[model samples]
Target: MSDVIRASAAPKPVGTYPHARRVGDLLFLSGIGPRDPATNAIPGNEYFADGRVRSYDITTQTQAVFANVRAVLEASGACWEDLVDVTVYLTDMARDFKAYNAVWAEYFPDIDTAPCRTTLGITALPTPIAIELKCTAVVRADNRQD
Candidate 1:
């Protein structure tokens, strides 16, 4: 059986989709951003209502994005260790890759436990956020420690 997972602690998806979908032992997550669930605010984003880009910090946004992804994983009865793969979308590759990689290493300290990852530089995202992460996780019965 398959199930859709919505995490109350994470920001609602920008489109009409659930945070994640589960089939068998795997959970596929939608692209997650750095928006705060309670305030709908994007951390480290400086795009104003006037459509001008100000200052965007990749490190700050990366931290928030990871937190949002964690909330979804937890809601789906999984954890960081269960993550098997991830695809990262970055608006500015030349400017942001170093900062993003630094934050990512903090989460996946060991190279052996780190998920396989692909990062793509895009022209833009649905929102003004600098980065978005889409991940797949292995959800074992014992991973539901919650």
Candidate 2:
């Protein structure tokens, strides 16, 4: 059986989907961005008056995106170490990969234990935000009932 997971501490999903879904021992997270749940704000996003993205700070946005992911993991009774894989989406890889990688290192310091990752350069995202994260984590032993 599978269960949908929602984290009130994270921004409500922009579309009709739960923050994550768990099946067996794995939790599959939806793509999460940098928007704040309480304020509906993107920390590092800068936009033009015409609603086009002018620029964004990759470091700050990466932090917020990870924070949101952390909230979802915690709500699901998991943690960073439980993460097994991740898919990263970036609107501008040439402009942002260095900053994003630096911030990512802070969370997963050791390469051996870090979750496997794949990053893609995309034209745009659902929001004006620059980056998004989708991940899979193993449910903690305590949270599992067989």
Candidate 3:
């Protein structure tokens, strides 16, 4: 009910959740999946393009998820540098953990200052997608009387 920030460039949310929400000086973003916004379809190889929902492999999926996160952060008046925490939910962590890390490294090159995070394996998510990420960021005020 307060100020809400939406990432117009990010893939649209499938349901009633904002890409991110801004409250006070913090922004809490909803989990993002891997479907490409341009097509609203998951990326697939040559054999699976008949509109039959196909789950993208870990690499492709993680990339899309990150893109979504980036879009949300930008729209919320924040950036990756402002990230304070993150949560990753996986339907099958054991199978895709390494792949997820591979993609994560590209974005978060410096782990020393990476935001506080937690990863968990869950039974299911909104879609058949493989990975999802949610994050929180702080928005520093510019004209503070300090």
The TM-scores, one per candidate, come to: 0.94, 0.94, 0.85
lDDT winner: 1
lDDT of 3 by residue, 19-121 (tens): 8878778888988887787877664322347744444587888888888787888777787778899899988899989989887888888988688889999
Tell me the TM-score of model 1: 0.94
lDDT of 1 by residue, 26-98 (tens): 9999999999999998888676689677888899999999999999999999998999999999999999999
Off by over 4 Å in 3: 44-55, 142-146
List the RMSD of every prediction in angstroms: 1.7, 1.6, 3.3
User: The CA-based lDDT of model 3 is what?
Assistant: 0.78
Q: Which runs of model 2 end up more than 4 angstroms from their true locations?
A: none
lDDT of 2 by residue, 1-146 (tens): 89889999999999999999999889999999999999998997788999776777889999999999999999988898899999999999999999999999989999999999999999999888999999999997786634
TM-score of structure candidate 2 = 0.94
Q: Would you list the C-alpha lDDT of every candidate in the order shown?
A: 0.93, 0.92, 0.78
Models sorted by lDDT, best on top: 1, 2, 3
